[model samples]
Target: MKLVLEILTGVLFVVEVGEGCTVAGLKDAIAAQEELPRDRIIFVLEGDPGRTIRRGEDGVPIVELGFRHGSHVYLFLEPEEDNGDDP
Candidate 1:
């Protein structure tokens, strides 16, 4: 299945998987695509936890990231810390 992902204040991408894809897989795909750090990214849906949607099993409804839809899905993006905090 092909999945589209969107980030609120960042970028969006699509994941085309043959068998199935989960939330974690989606995150991995995004990270792989942007070459960004995983810890800096956040995913959510409809103001709720995005991980819940991600953890859902096969056949479960998923938010297409890069689509123009209603308030069904929401993806937020925030850049992670680029360097260690000053002591």
Candidate 2:
């Protein structure tokens, strides 16, 4: 399926994955396409209110979660931790 990832910054990315792709795999695709950290990626599934897909649900396949071709999802990238280097 072809999914559209809209990051918090308004940057958009299109990821192509197999039908068997799981949430974890989807995150991996997003990270690879945008050079982001998979661990920090969260998903707000379209039409699923109050449900934020996270790492714990990685085992679940996206197809089973009501996703289809051209499915749009909001990608929330967890803010990076501020190290001591910050002034």
Using TM-score as the measure, the top candidate is 2
> Which residue runs of candidate 2 sit more than 4 Å off their true CA positions?
48-50, 81-87
lDDT of each: 0.49, 0.85
Output the worst ten-in-a-row residue range by lDDT, candidate 1: 65-74
> How much is the lDDT of residue 80 in candidate 2?
82
lDDT tens digits by residue: candidate 1, 1-87: 554556665565665644345455655666788675554555555442334243233233334442223333445556545687777
lDDT score of residue 50 within candidate 1: 32
Q: Lowest-scoring 10 consecutive residues by lDDT in candidate 2?
A: 46-55
lDDT of 2 by residue, 1-87 (tens): 899878878888789999999999998888888898999998987774645787688999998887789988889978788888978
Provide TM-scores for the models: 0.45, 0.83
Candidate 1, residue 13: the lDDT equals 64
Give the candidate number with the greatest lDDT.
2
